[model samples]
Target: MSKTVVFIQGSPRENGNTRALAALVMETLAQSGVASAEIDATRLQCSHPGCIACGRCQEGPEFRCHVDDGLARAVATLPDYDAVVLSTPVFWLGPTAQAKMCVDRMASLVKCSDAGALATPLRGKILGLFATGATERDENLDILERQYRVMAEYLGMPFVSALFPFCGVPAGQAAADPEFATVARDFGVRLAGMLGGRKCCDP
Candidate 1:
Protein backbone atom coordinates (compact mmCIF):
# COMPACT_ATOMS: atom_id res chain seq x y z
CA MET A 1 0.00 0.00 0.00
CA SER A 2 1.10 3.54 -0.63
CA LYS A 3 2.19 5.47 2.44
CA THR A 4 0.14 8.43 3.56
CA VAL A 5 1.51 11.73 4.78
CA VAL A 6 -0.21 14.72 6.34
CA PHE A 7 1.12 18.24 6.06
CA ILE A 8 -0.02 20.33 8.98
CA GLN A 9 0.04 24.00 7.95
CA GLY A 10 1.03 25.59 11.23
CA SER A 11 1.54 29.11 9.98
CA PRO A 12 -1.11 31.66 10.83
CA ARG A 13 0.22 33.88 8.06
CA GLU A 14 -0.55 32.68 4.57
CA ASN A 15 1.46 33.26 1.38
CA GLY A 16 4.63 33.52 3.37
CA ASN A 17 8.05 31.97 2.93
CA THR A 18 7.23 28.93 5.05
CA ARG A 19 4.06 28.21 3.11
CA ALA A 20 5.90 28.43 -0.19
CA LEU A 21 8.57 25.97 0.92
CA ALA A 22 5.90 23.63 2.24
CA ALA A 23 4.19 23.65 -1.13
CA LEU A 24 7.42 22.66 -2.81
CA VAL A 25 7.87 19.73 -0.44
CA MET A 26 4.32 18.55 -0.97
CA GLU A 27 4.73 18.74 -4.70
CA THR A 28 7.81 16.55 -4.55
CA LEU A 29 5.99 13.98 -2.48
CA ALA A 30 3.12 13.94 -4.93
CA GLN A 31 5.43 13.39 -7.88
CA SER A 32 7.03 10.54 -5.97
CA GLY A 33 3.61 8.89 -5.67
CA VAL A 34 3.16 9.33 -1.93
CA ALA A 35 -0.38 9.90 -0.78
CA SER A 36 -0.81 13.14 1.12
CA ALA A 37 -3.27 15.49 2.75
CA GLU A 38 -3.12 18.73 4.72
CA ILE A 39 -4.50 20.35 7.84
CA ASP A 40 -4.31 24.12 8.20
CA ALA A 41 -4.10 25.26 11.81
CA THR A 42 -5.28 28.72 10.87
CA ARG A 43 -8.53 27.27 9.61
CA LEU A 44 -9.25 24.92 12.51
CA GLN A 45 -12.64 25.78 13.93
CA CYS A 46 -12.20 24.83 17.56
CA SER A 47 -14.26 26.36 20.29
CA HIS A 48 -11.72 24.88 22.72
CA PRO A 49 -8.37 25.37 21.10
CA GLY A 50 -5.41 23.62 22.90
CA CYS A 51 -5.47 20.82 25.45
CA ILE A 52 -7.63 21.39 28.50
CA ALA A 53 -6.37 18.26 30.31
CA CYS A 54 -9.92 17.16 30.96
CA GLY A 55 -8.89 13.50 31.03
CA ARG A 56 -11.87 12.58 28.88
CA CYS A 57 -9.75 11.04 26.14
CA GLN A 58 -7.60 9.20 28.67
CA GLU A 59 -10.63 7.41 30.09
CA GLY A 60 -10.44 4.66 27.48
CA PRO A 61 -8.18 3.40 24.75
CA GLU A 62 -10.93 3.84 22.19
CA PHE A 63 -11.48 7.46 23.14
CA ARG A 64 -9.16 9.90 21.42
CA CYS A 65 -9.56 13.65 21.61
CA HIS A 66 -13.00 14.06 23.13
CA VAL A 67 -13.21 17.77 22.41
CA ASP A 68 -16.01 18.71 20.08
CA ASP A 69 -14.20 20.72 17.43
CA GLY A 70 -12.60 20.53 14.02
CA LEU A 71 -9.11 20.28 15.49
CA ALA A 72 -10.14 17.44 17.76
CA ARG A 73 -11.62 15.53 14.88
CA ALA A 74 -8.63 16.25 12.65
CA VAL A 75 -6.00 15.17 15.15
CA ALA A 76 -7.94 12.08 16.23
CA THR A 77 -7.25 10.53 12.83
CA LEU A 78 -3.50 11.15 12.77
CA PRO A 79 -2.84 7.54 13.67
CA ASP A 80 -4.18 6.49 10.33
CA TYR A 81 -1.36 8.26 8.50
CA ASP A 82 2.21 7.09 8.06
CA ALA A 83 3.83 10.47 8.57
CA VAL A 84 3.10 14.01 9.75
CA VAL A 85 4.97 17.13 8.63
CA LEU A 86 4.46 20.31 10.60
CA SER A 87 5.11 23.28 8.33
CA THR A 88 5.39 26.54 10.16
CA PRO A 89 7.28 29.81 10.36
CA VAL A 90 9.42 30.48 13.39
CA PHE A 91 8.16 33.33 15.50
CA TRP A 92 9.47 34.60 18.85
CA LEU A 93 12.17 31.92 19.02
CA GLY A 94 9.75 29.05 18.38
CA PRO A 95 6.94 27.81 16.21
CA THR A 96 4.17 30.22 15.49
CA ALA A 97 1.42 30.50 18.11
CA GLN A 98 -0.99 28.72 15.80
CA ALA A 99 1.36 25.79 15.36
CA LYS A 100 2.31 25.45 19.00
CA MET A 101 -1.30 25.57 20.05
CA CYS A 102 -2.11 22.73 17.68
CA VAL A 103 0.71 20.68 19.10
CA ASP A 104 -0.47 21.43 22.64
CA ARG A 105 -3.97 20.25 21.89
CA MET A 106 -2.68 17.07 20.27
CA ALA A 107 -1.75 15.91 23.77
CA SER A 108 -5.29 14.60 23.88
CA LEU A 109 -4.22 11.93 21.39
CA VAL A 110 -2.16 10.21 24.04
CA LYS A 111 -3.99 7.32 25.65
CA CYS A 112 -2.57 6.05 28.89
CA SER A 113 -3.50 2.58 30.03
CA ASP A 114 -4.60 1.73 33.54
CA ALA A 115 -1.22 0.08 34.11
CA GLY A 116 0.41 3.51 33.96
CA ALA A 117 1.77 2.88 30.50
CA LEU A 118 1.73 5.84 28.18
CA ALA A 119 0.77 5.22 24.57
CA THR A 120 0.06 7.72 21.86
CA PRO A 121 -1.52 7.14 18.47
CA LEU A 122 1.40 8.89 16.81
CA ARG A 123 3.75 6.06 17.62
CA GLY A 124 5.49 4.20 14.77
CA LYS A 125 4.88 7.14 12.48
CA ILE A 126 7.43 9.56 11.10
CA LEU A 127 7.39 13.19 12.21
CA GLY A 128 9.03 15.96 10.26
CA LEU A 129 9.31 19.72 10.55
CA PHE A 130 9.64 22.26 7.78
CA ALA A 131 10.41 25.50 9.51
CA THR A 132 11.80 28.82 8.31
CA GLY A 133 13.04 31.58 10.53
CA ALA A 134 14.77 34.95 10.44
CA THR A 135 18.33 35.57 11.67
CA GLU A 136 21.14 33.04 11.86
CA ARG A 137 20.33 29.35 12.10
CA ASP A 138 22.21 28.69 15.35
CA GLU A 139 20.53 31.60 17.00
CA ASN A 140 16.94 30.61 16.25
CA LEU A 141 16.32 27.68 13.90
CA ASP A 142 18.66 25.37 15.78
CA ILE A 143 16.84 26.14 18.97
CA LEU A 144 13.61 25.04 17.31
CA GLU A 145 15.26 21.86 16.04
CA ARG A 146 16.51 20.96 19.49
CA GLN A 147 13.02 21.25 20.93
CA TYR A 148 11.49 19.18 18.12
CA ARG A 149 14.20 16.53 18.38
CA VAL A 150 13.43 16.11 22.05
CA MET A 151 9.74 15.88 21.26
CA ALA A 152 10.31 13.16 18.65
CA GLU A 153 12.63 11.22 20.94
CA TYR A 154 10.05 11.18 23.72
CA LEU A 155 7.28 10.23 21.32
CA GLY A 156 9.34 7.38 19.81
CA MET A 157 8.91 8.70 16.31
CA PRO A 158 11.72 9.04 13.80
CA PHE A 159 12.40 12.68 13.07
CA VAL A 160 13.47 14.63 10.00
CA SER A 161 13.59 18.35 9.35
CA ALA A 162 14.08 21.12 6.82
CA LEU A 163 15.29 24.08 8.82
CA PHE A 164 15.87 27.25 6.83
CA PRO A 165 17.26 30.21 8.73
CA PHE A 166 17.82 33.76 7.54
CA CYS A 167 14.61 33.44 5.66
CA GLY A 168 11.57 35.66 5.34
CA VAL A 169 13.48 38.83 6.00
CA PRO A 170 10.99 40.84 4.03
CA ALA A 171 8.15 38.37 4.25
CA GLY A 172 8.11 35.87 1.35
CA GLN A 173 11.64 36.69 0.32
CA ALA A 174 12.71 33.08 0.52
CA ALA A 175 9.95 32.09 -1.88
CA ALA A 176 11.72 33.89 -4.67
CA ASP A 177 14.99 32.08 -4.19
CA PRO A 178 15.57 29.07 -6.45
CA GLU A 179 17.93 27.65 -3.83
CA PHE A 180 15.09 27.39 -1.36
CA ALA A 181 13.04 25.35 -3.79
CA THR A 182 15.94 22.96 -4.38
CA VAL A 183 16.41 22.50 -0.65
CA ALA A 184 12.72 21.89 -0.10
CA ARG A 185 12.58 19.34 -2.88
CA ASP A 186 15.54 17.49 -1.40
CA PHE A 187 13.98 17.57 2.05
CA GLY A 188 10.75 16.17 0.70
CA VAL A 189 12.60 13.23 -0.76
CA ARG A 190 14.25 12.60 2.58
CA LEU A 191 10.86 12.65 4.30
CA ALA A 192 9.44 10.29 1.70
CA GLY A 193 12.34 7.92 2.27
CA MET A 194 11.10 7.37 5.81
CA LEU A 195 7.89 6.04 4.26
CA GLY A 196 9.80 3.95 1.70
CA GLY A 197 9.07 6.16 -1.30
CA ARG A 198 11.43 7.16 -4.09
CA LYS A 199 11.26 9.84 -6.73
CA CYS A 200 9.70 8.36 -9.86
CA CYS A 201 8.88 11.62 -11.56
CA ASP A 202 9.94 15.21 -11.50
CA PRO A 203 7.93 17.44 -9.18
Candidate 2:
Protein backbone atom coordinates (compact mmCIF):
# COMPACT_ATOMS: atom_id res chain seq x y z
CA MET A 1 0.00 0.00 0.00
CA SER A 2 1.10 3.58 -0.58
CA LYS A 3 2.21 5.65 2.39
CA THR A 4 0.04 8.72 2.77
CA VAL A 5 1.74 12.07 3.48
CA VAL A 6 -0.19 15.08 4.74
CA PHE A 7 1.29 18.51 3.90
CA ILE A 8 0.00 21.62 5.64
CA GLN A 9 0.45 24.93 3.80
CA GLY A 10 0.34 27.88 6.19
CA SER A 11 0.62 30.83 3.86
CA PRO A 12 -2.30 33.01 2.87
CA ARG A 13 -1.06 33.51 -0.64
CA GLU A 14 -2.15 30.50 -2.66
CA ASN A 15 0.64 30.88 -5.19
CA GLY A 16 3.27 32.57 -3.08
CA ASN A 17 6.88 31.49 -2.78
CA THR A 18 6.13 29.33 0.25
CA ARG A 19 3.44 27.48 -1.66
CA ALA A 20 5.72 27.12 -4.66
CA LEU A 21 8.38 25.53 -2.51
CA ALA A 22 5.80 23.24 -0.95
CA ALA A 23 4.59 22.23 -4.39
CA LEU A 24 8.09 21.38 -5.51
CA VAL A 25 8.54 19.17 -2.48
CA MET A 26 5.25 17.43 -3.16
CA GLU A 27 6.24 16.89 -6.77
CA THR A 28 9.47 15.26 -5.72
CA LEU A 29 7.52 12.97 -3.41
CA ALA A 30 5.21 12.05 -6.27
CA GLN A 31 8.20 11.16 -8.41
CA SER A 32 9.11 8.68 -5.69
CA GLY A 33 5.61 7.21 -6.00
CA VAL A 34 4.29 8.19 -2.56
CA ALA A 35 0.67 9.18 -1.96
CA SER A 36 0.24 12.72 -0.59
CA ALA A 37 -2.39 15.28 0.40
CA GLU A 38 -1.88 19.03 0.77
CA ILE A 39 -4.02 20.93 3.24
CA ASP A 40 -4.05 24.73 2.95
CA ALA A 41 -4.77 26.28 6.32
CA THR A 42 -5.53 29.60 4.66
CA ARG A 43 -8.62 28.08 3.15
CA LEU A 44 -9.78 26.43 6.33
CA GLN A 45 -12.06 28.06 8.86
CA CYS A 46 -10.29 27.94 12.23
CA SER A 47 -11.23 29.94 15.28
CA HIS A 48 -8.03 31.07 16.93
CA PRO A 49 -9.45 34.56 17.58
CA GLY A 50 -8.99 33.95 21.28
CA CYS A 51 -8.69 31.08 23.67
CA ILE A 52 -12.05 30.62 25.30
CA ALA A 53 -10.39 28.23 27.71
CA CYS A 54 -13.59 26.24 27.82
CA GLY A 55 -13.44 22.76 29.35
CA ARG A 56 -15.71 21.32 26.70
CA CYS A 57 -14.11 18.65 24.49
CA GLN A 58 -11.40 18.12 27.07
CA GLU A 59 -12.55 14.55 27.69
CA GLY A 60 -14.07 13.25 24.48
CA PRO A 61 -12.23 11.72 21.52
CA GLU A 62 -8.76 13.15 21.62
CA PHE A 63 -9.33 14.97 18.35
CA ARG A 64 -12.18 17.02 19.71
CA CYS A 65 -11.52 20.77 19.96
CA HIS A 66 -13.52 23.28 22.03
CA VAL A 67 -13.95 25.51 19.03
CA ASP A 68 -16.04 24.52 16.01
CA ASP A 69 -13.86 24.98 12.93
CA GLY A 70 -11.87 23.28 10.18
CA LEU A 71 -9.15 22.35 12.63
CA ALA A 72 -11.52 19.85 14.17
CA ARG A 73 -12.00 18.09 10.87
CA ALA A 74 -8.28 18.02 10.14
CA VAL A 75 -7.42 16.75 13.60
CA ALA A 76 -10.00 14.00 13.37
CA THR A 77 -8.37 12.52 10.28
CA LEU A 78 -4.67 13.35 10.89
CA PRO A 79 -3.90 10.01 12.48
CA ASP A 80 -4.63 8.17 9.27
CA TYR A 81 -1.57 9.58 7.56
CA ASP A 82 1.90 8.09 7.91
CA ALA A 83 3.73 11.40 7.83
CA VAL A 84 2.92 15.08 8.41
CA VAL A 85 4.68 18.07 6.83
CA LEU A 86 4.13 21.70 7.79
CA SER A 87 5.10 24.50 5.38
CA THR A 88 4.83 28.10 6.44
CA PRO A 89 6.24 31.56 5.82
CA VAL A 90 7.94 33.44 8.60
CA PHE A 91 5.82 36.29 9.88
CA TRP A 92 7.34 38.42 12.65
CA LEU A 93 10.00 35.78 13.23
CA GLY A 94 7.49 32.97 13.64
CA PRO A 95 4.94 30.93 11.80
CA THR A 96 2.17 32.79 10.07
CA ALA A 97 -1.01 33.18 12.08
CA GLN A 98 -2.82 30.81 9.77
CA ALA A 99 -0.49 27.91 10.49
CA LYS A 100 -0.04 28.67 14.18
CA MET A 101 -3.74 28.36 14.82
CA CYS A 102 -4.00 24.95 13.27
CA VAL A 103 -1.05 23.60 15.19
CA ASP A 104 -2.27 25.13 18.42
CA ARG A 105 -5.67 23.54 17.99
CA MET A 106 -3.95 20.19 18.21
CA ALA A 107 -3.36 20.90 21.88
CA SER A 108 -6.55 19.10 22.72
CA LEU A 109 -5.10 15.81 21.51
CA VAL A 110 -1.85 16.15 23.40
CA LYS A 111 -3.55 17.28 26.59
CA CYS A 112 -5.87 14.28 26.71
CA SER A 113 -3.15 11.70 26.18
CA ASP A 114 -1.59 10.15 29.26
CA ALA A 115 2.05 11.02 29.89
CA GLY A 116 4.62 8.38 28.81
CA ALA A 117 2.00 7.22 26.34
CA LEU A 118 1.94 8.18 22.68
CA ALA A 119 -0.14 11.20 21.75
CA THR A 120 -3.42 10.15 20.21
CA PRO A 121 -3.17 11.61 16.69
CA LEU A 122 0.55 11.72 15.99
CA ARG A 123 1.77 8.59 17.71
CA GLY A 124 4.52 6.83 15.76
CA LYS A 125 4.13 9.31 12.93
CA ILE A 126 6.96 11.30 11.30
CA LEU A 127 6.87 15.10 11.46
CA GLY A 128 8.65 17.37 8.97
CA LEU A 129 9.04 21.15 8.78
CA PHE A 130 9.34 23.40 5.72
CA ALA A 131 9.56 27.17 5.83
CA THR A 132 10.26 30.33 3.80
CA GLY A 133 11.28 33.77 4.96
CA ALA A 134 11.67 37.24 3.42
CA THR A 135 15.04 37.94 5.03
CA GLU A 136 17.52 36.68 7.59
CA ARG A 137 17.00 32.97 7.26
CA ASP A 138 19.48 32.62 10.05
CA GLU A 139 17.13 34.10 12.62
CA ASN A 140 13.73 33.27 11.17
CA LEU A 141 14.67 29.70 10.37
CA ASP A 142 16.00 29.17 13.86
CA ILE A 143 12.71 30.26 15.36
CA LEU A 144 10.75 27.89 13.18
CA GLU A 145 13.15 25.05 13.91
CA ARG A 146 12.73 25.47 17.63
CA GLN A 147 8.98 25.70 17.30
CA TYR A 148 8.75 22.46 15.36
CA ARG A 149 11.20 20.73 17.64
CA VAL A 150 9.19 21.60 20.71
CA MET A 151 6.00 20.64 18.96
CA ALA A 152 7.32 17.28 17.83
CA GLU A 153 8.81 16.52 21.20
CA TYR A 154 5.58 17.31 22.97
CA LEU A 155 3.57 15.16 20.60
CA GLY A 156 6.09 12.33 20.97
CA MET A 157 6.62 12.16 17.21
CA PRO A 158 9.91 11.76 15.45
CA PHE A 159 11.25 15.11 14.21
CA VAL A 160 12.44 13.95 10.84
CA SER A 161 13.93 17.01 9.08
CA ALA A 162 13.30 20.53 7.83
CA LEU A 163 13.72 22.52 4.61
CA PHE A 164 14.31 26.26 4.80
CA PRO A 165 14.30 28.29 1.61
CA PHE A 166 15.48 31.86 2.07
CA CYS A 167 13.34 34.05 -0.13
CA GLY A 168 13.64 37.41 1.52
CA VAL A 169 14.13 39.27 -1.75
CA PRO A 170 10.66 39.61 -3.24
CA ALA A 171 7.38 37.92 -4.03
CA GLY A 172 8.54 35.55 -6.81
CA GLN A 173 12.25 35.54 -6.10
CA ALA A 174 12.42 32.14 -4.42
CA ALA A 175 12.03 30.45 -7.77
CA ALA A 176 15.32 31.95 -8.82
CA ASP A 177 17.14 30.34 -5.92
CA PRO A 178 18.32 27.19 -7.66
CA GLU A 179 20.07 25.87 -4.59
CA PHE A 180 16.99 26.24 -2.44
CA ALA A 181 14.85 24.38 -4.94
CA THR A 182 17.37 21.57 -5.08
CA VAL A 183 17.34 21.23 -1.32
CA ALA A 184 13.56 21.27 -1.23
CA ARG A 185 13.40 18.56 -3.88
CA ASP A 186 15.88 16.44 -2.00
CA PHE A 187 13.92 16.87 1.21
CA GLY A 188 10.80 15.61 -0.53
CA VAL A 189 12.57 12.60 -1.95
CA ARG A 190 13.98 11.70 1.45
CA LEU A 191 10.64 12.13 3.15
CA ALA A 192 8.97 9.89 0.60
CA GLY A 193 11.70 7.29 0.98
CA MET A 194 11.39 7.30 4.75
CA LEU A 195 7.64 6.80 4.72
CA GLY A 196 7.67 4.34 1.84
CA GLY A 197 10.32 2.21 3.48
CA ARG A 198 8.49 1.96 6.79
CA LYS A 199 7.80 -1.55 8.09
CA CYS A 200 4.41 -0.89 9.58
CA CYS A 201 1.53 -0.79 7.14
CA ASP A 202 -0.83 2.13 6.88
CA PRO A 203 -3.59 2.03 9.46
Candidate 3:
Protein backbone atom coordinates (compact mmCIF):
# COMPACT_ATOMS: atom_id res chain seq x y z
CA MET A 1 0.00 0.00 0.00
CA SER A 2 1.11 3.57 -0.63
CA LYS A 3 1.88 5.93 2.25
CA THR A 4 2.09 9.66 2.81
CA VAL A 5 5.43 11.24 3.67
CA VAL A 6 5.57 14.85 4.80
CA PHE A 7 8.92 16.60 4.60
CA ILE A 8 9.48 19.80 6.54
CA GLN A 9 12.31 21.88 5.19
CA GLY A 10 13.78 24.09 7.90
CA SER A 11 16.40 26.02 6.02
CA PRO A 12 16.02 29.68 5.18
CA ARG A 13 18.20 29.31 2.11
CA GLU A 14 16.03 27.47 -0.39
CA ASN A 15 18.89 25.58 -2.03
CA GLY A 16 21.13 25.15 0.95
CA ASN A 17 22.83 21.90 1.85
CA THR A 18 19.99 20.86 4.14
CA ARG A 19 17.40 21.38 1.42
CA ALA A 20 19.52 19.47 -1.11
CA LEU A 21 19.68 16.49 1.24
CA ALA A 22 15.94 16.65 1.78
CA ALA A 23 15.39 16.75 -1.98
CA LEU A 24 17.49 13.63 -2.40
CA VAL A 25 15.40 11.82 0.15
CA MET A 26 12.20 12.87 -1.57
CA GLU A 27 13.51 11.61 -4.90
CA THR A 28 14.36 8.24 -3.43
CA LEU A 29 10.94 7.97 -1.82
CA ALA A 30 9.29 8.60 -5.19
CA GLN A 31 10.76 5.34 -6.48
CA SER A 32 8.68 3.45 -3.90
CA GLY A 33 5.36 4.97 -5.01
CA VAL A 34 4.81 6.81 -1.76
CA ALA A 35 2.83 10.06 -1.74
CA SER A 36 5.10 12.90 -0.69
CA ALA A 37 4.51 16.53 0.24
CA GLU A 38 6.95 19.15 1.40
CA ILE A 39 6.69 22.42 3.31
CA ASP A 40 9.41 25.02 3.55
CA ALA A 41 8.94 26.48 7.00
CA THR A 42 11.62 29.07 6.47
CA ARG A 43 9.61 30.64 3.69
CA LEU A 44 6.46 30.53 5.77
CA GLN A 45 5.81 32.42 8.92
CA CYS A 46 5.11 30.21 11.95
CA SER A 47 4.27 31.97 15.18
CA HIS A 48 4.76 29.95 18.33
CA PRO A 49 3.08 31.58 21.30
CA GLY A 50 4.44 29.27 23.94
CA CYS A 51 1.96 26.56 24.95
CA ILE A 52 -0.73 27.70 27.33
CA ALA A 53 -2.18 25.54 30.07
CA CYS A 54 -5.34 25.05 28.02
CA GLY A 55 -6.75 21.55 27.50
CA ARG A 56 -9.18 22.01 24.64
CA CYS A 57 -7.79 19.48 22.19
CA GLN A 58 -7.47 16.90 24.95
CA GLU A 59 -11.19 17.09 25.55
CA GLY A 60 -11.94 15.14 22.35
CA PRO A 61 -10.50 13.47 19.29
CA GLU A 62 -10.66 16.64 17.27
CA PHE A 63 -7.39 18.08 15.91
CA ARG A 64 -7.30 21.78 16.59
CA CYS A 65 -4.85 24.50 17.49
CA HIS A 66 -5.16 27.99 18.97
CA VAL A 67 -2.93 29.79 16.54
CA ASP A 68 -3.88 30.14 12.88
CA ASP A 69 -1.07 30.21 10.35
CA GLY A 70 0.96 28.01 8.02
CA LEU A 71 2.21 26.07 11.00
CA ALA A 72 -1.35 25.20 12.00
CA ARG A 73 -2.13 24.03 8.48
CA ALA A 74 1.00 21.89 8.57
CA VAL A 75 0.10 20.49 11.97
CA ALA A 76 -3.41 19.68 10.79
CA THR A 77 -1.93 17.52 8.04
CA LEU A 78 0.36 15.44 10.26
CA PRO A 79 -2.02 12.60 11.06
CA ASP A 80 -2.75 12.04 7.39
CA TYR A 81 0.78 10.90 6.69
CA ASP A 82 2.31 7.54 7.55
CA ALA A 83 5.73 9.07 8.00
CA VAL A 84 7.17 12.50 8.81
CA VAL A 85 10.60 13.82 7.94
CA LEU A 86 12.16 16.94 9.43
CA SER A 87 15.10 18.50 7.59
CA THR A 88 17.05 21.35 9.09
CA PRO A 89 20.42 23.02 9.11
CA VAL A 90 22.25 23.01 12.40
CA PHE A 91 21.68 26.29 14.23
CA TRP A 92 23.80 26.73 17.31
CA LEU A 93 24.43 22.98 17.29
CA GLY A 94 20.71 22.11 17.35
CA PRO A 95 17.50 22.64 15.42
CA THR A 96 16.90 25.88 13.55
CA ALA A 97 14.22 28.35 14.62
CA GLN A 98 11.94 27.23 11.80
CA ALA A 99 12.10 23.61 12.84
CA LYS A 100 11.67 24.40 16.52
CA MET A 101 8.62 26.53 15.84
CA CYS A 102 6.87 23.78 13.94
CA VAL A 103 7.50 21.19 16.61
CA ASP A 104 6.62 23.50 19.49
CA ARG A 105 3.34 24.45 17.87
CA MET A 106 2.24 20.84 18.01
CA ALA A 107 1.44 21.09 21.70
CA SER A 108 -2.25 20.85 20.98
CA LEU A 109 -1.96 17.14 20.21
CA VAL A 110 -0.10 16.18 23.36
CA LYS A 111 -1.91 15.53 26.62
CA CYS A 112 -0.47 14.25 29.87
CA SER A 113 -0.94 10.51 30.33
CA ASP A 114 -2.89 10.99 33.55
CA ALA A 115 -5.19 13.51 31.88
CA GLY A 116 -7.28 10.64 30.41
CA ALA A 117 -7.16 12.17 26.96
CA LEU A 118 -7.60 10.13 23.81
CA ALA A 119 -4.53 8.67 22.20
CA THR A 120 -2.34 11.08 20.28
CA PRO A 121 -2.94 11.06 16.54
CA LEU A 122 0.77 10.70 15.88
CA ARG A 123 1.08 7.42 17.74
CA GLY A 124 2.61 4.53 15.81
CA LYS A 125 3.81 6.70 12.92
CA ILE A 126 7.35 6.59 11.55
CA LEU A 127 9.53 9.67 12.09
CA GLY A 128 12.83 10.43 10.39
CA LEU A 129 15.35 13.27 10.55
CA PHE A 130 17.95 14.80 8.21
CA ALA A 131 20.34 17.55 9.21
CA THR A 132 23.28 19.44 7.67
CA GLY A 133 26.04 21.27 9.45
CA ALA A 134 29.16 23.27 8.69
CA THR A 135 31.61 20.75 10.08
CA GLU A 136 31.51 17.04 10.92
CA ARG A 137 31.67 16.78 14.65
CA ASP A 138 30.41 14.03 16.91
CA GLU A 139 29.28 16.50 19.59
CA ASN A 140 27.14 18.68 17.33
CA LEU A 141 25.51 15.68 15.69
CA ASP A 142 24.64 14.35 19.11
CA ILE A 143 22.79 17.56 19.88
CA LEU A 144 20.79 17.38 16.66
CA GLU A 145 19.91 13.71 17.22
CA ARG A 146 18.70 14.33 20.75
CA GLN A 147 16.47 17.21 19.63
CA TYR A 148 14.73 15.03 17.04
CA ARG A 149 14.34 12.20 19.54
CA VAL A 150 12.61 14.56 21.94
CA MET A 151 10.25 15.72 19.23
CA ALA A 152 9.35 12.16 18.23
CA GLU A 153 8.75 11.12 21.80
CA TYR A 154 6.51 14.06 22.59
CA LEU A 155 4.49 13.60 19.42
CA GLY A 156 4.06 9.86 20.04
CA MET A 157 5.87 8.98 16.82
CA PRO A 158 8.50 6.26 16.61
CA PHE A 159 12.02 7.64 16.64
CA VAL A 160 13.76 6.15 13.63
CA SER A 161 17.26 6.68 12.30
CA ALA A 162 18.64 10.16 11.64
CA LEU A 163 20.83 11.00 8.62
CA PHE A 164 23.34 13.76 9.34
CA PRO A 165 25.80 15.15 6.79
CA PHE A 166 28.51 17.53 7.83
CA CYS A 167 29.11 19.77 4.87
CA GLY A 168 32.74 20.79 4.61
CA VAL A 169 34.09 24.02 6.14
CA PRO A 170 31.61 26.03 4.15
CA ALA A 171 28.14 25.68 5.65
CA GLY A 172 26.03 25.03 2.56
CA GLN A 173 28.22 22.55 0.66
CA ALA A 174 26.82 19.08 1.25
CA ALA A 175 27.33 18.03 -2.36
CA ALA A 176 31.05 18.21 -1.73
CA ASP A 177 30.56 14.95 0.14
CA PRO A 178 28.93 12.77 -2.50
CA GLU A 179 28.76 9.83 -0.09
CA PHE A 180 26.36 11.82 2.08
CA ALA A 181 23.87 12.13 -0.75
CA THR A 182 23.81 8.36 -1.11
CA VAL A 183 23.14 8.08 2.60
CA ALA A 184 20.19 10.44 2.28
CA ARG A 185 18.76 8.33 -0.55
CA ASP A 186 19.10 5.18 1.51
CA PHE A 187 17.38 6.88 4.41
CA GLY A 188 14.43 7.71 2.22
CA VAL A 189 13.97 4.14 0.95
CA ARG A 190 14.16 2.72 4.44
CA LEU A 191 11.63 5.21 5.78
CA ALA A 192 9.23 4.40 2.96
CA GLY A 193 9.45 0.70 3.78
CA MET A 194 8.70 1.43 7.41
CA LEU A 195 5.69 3.53 6.56
CA GLY A 196 4.27 0.90 4.24
CA GLY A 197 4.68 -1.82 6.84
CA ARG A 198 3.04 0.29 9.54
CA LYS A 199 -0.16 0.93 7.58
CA CYS A 200 -0.50 4.30 9.22
CA CYS A 201 -2.96 5.90 6.84
CA ASP A 202 -5.13 8.43 8.64
CA PRO A 203 -8.91 8.51 8.82
Q: lDDT, candidate 1, residue 80?
A: 88
State the lDDT at 145 in candidate 3: 84
**Model 2 residue 109 CA deviation in Å:** 2.0
Q: Pick the candidate with the highest lDDT.
A: 1
State the lDDT of candidate 2 residue by residue for 1-203, as single tens digits.
87888988888887688887777877777777777898877778766542356767566654577687776677656778898888888888888887877676666666444555544668778888888876766777887888788878877787765546457656655756888788778788778777764322323
lDDT of 1 by residue, 1-203 (tens): 88889988987778788887888888888778788888888898888868887888767656467788988888877788999888888888888777776788778767656797878878879989889887889988898998988888878899999988778566666766888878898988988877888665644
After TM-score superposition, the amount by which residue 90's alpha carbon in candidate 2 deviates from its true location, in angstroms, is 0.4
Query: Which residue pairs in candidate 3 have backbone atoms (N, alpha carbon, C) closer than 3 angstroms, thus clashing?
Result: none
What is the TM-score (0 to 1) of candidate 2?
0.85
Off by over 4 Å in 1: 113-116, 201-203
Q: Could you tell me the lDDT of residue 177 within candidate 2?
A: 81
Using TM-score as the measure, the top candidate is 1
On residues 83-188, what C-alpha lDDT tens digit does candidate 3 reach at each position?
A: 8778877788877887777776666766555766536778888777777766665768777788779878866678766556457434456655678777887787
lDDT of 3: 0.72
Candidate 1 TM-score, true structure as reference: 0.92
Clashes of 3: 0
Superposition error at 14 for model 2 (Å): 1.3
Provide the overall lDDT of each model, using Cα atoms, as 2-decimal numbers: 0.82, 0.74, 0.72
